[model samples]
Target: MAVYTVAQVKINDGERYEKYRERFGAVLQQYDGRLVAADDNPVVQEGQWSYEKIVILEFADLDAFNAFADSESYREIAAHRHAGADSLILVAKGR
Candidate 1:
């Protein structure tokens, strides 16, 4: 089964986030991750909530997701995210 990762982030530093944007794309490519959605200023149709940005990624399976998430490439990109944003990430098995 495929696995999906959903991340909601509030960017604290725009310049640093931009740097992460580039670096993260490269890391995703290296790991064969598919970008389902990458959006800023998301619209909430029926909820009281707040988020600066949202990203959704799809992997071949749980192991593939784990491989990418735990890889060195991701680690390097993660530092930029740590400095740039506050985020919540969750994984779910796709239907």
Candidate 2:
């Protein structure tokens, strides 16, 4: 099954988050994952939304997603994201 990751993010430190962004593409290329969408300013249809950005990613499968998300390389860069922003991530299985 295909897998998708959706993240709602609120940035606290632009510099460190930028560092994660800069290295993300290269690291992602090493796995079966693709960046699907990223929006810094998205119009909320309803309810309150406090996040500054929304990101979406697609992977070939759960294992592929894990390969990327659990990799040492990703963990290294994710530390920057962790320090720079607050993020809520969700993984969904696609039919």
Candidate 3:
């Protein structure tokens, strides 16, 4: 099954975030992950939204997602995200 990663982030450090953005695509490519959607201002049709940005990623399966997300290379890069933003990340199985 395909898996999707949905991340909602509020940036606190532009420099760090930019660093993360720079390296993210290369890391994703290493694991066959695809950038599905990334928006700084997403339109919310209903309910309430609080995050400053939203990023969605797709992977071949749960294992693929984990392999990419949990890899050491990604972990090294993710340090910027940890320092730069407050975020909510979720994984969902695509229908």
Tens digits of per-residue lDDT for model 1 on 1-95?
Answer: 99999999999998887788888878888778899998888888897766778899999999998899899888888888889999999999998
- Poorest stretch of ten by lDDT in candidate 2: 25-34
Residue 7, model 1: Cα distance from true site in angstroms: 0.7
lDDT of 3 by residue, 1-95 (tens): 99999999999999999999999999999999999999999888899988889999999999999999899999999999999999999999999
TM-score of 3: 0.97
- In angstroms, how far off is 2's CA in candidate 1? 0.5
Model 2, span 11-61: residue lDDT tens? 999999999999999898899588999999988999998898999999999
- As a whole number from 0 to 100, the lDDT of residue 52 in candidate 2 is 88
Clashes of 1: 0
For model 1, which pairs clash? none
**lDDT score, residue 48, model 1?**
75
Off by over 4 Å in 1: none
Candidate 1 deviates by what RMSD? Answer: 1.0
TM-score pick, better of 1 and 2: 2
Best-fitting candidate, scored by lDDT: 3
TM-scores for every predicted model: 0.93, 0.97, 0.97
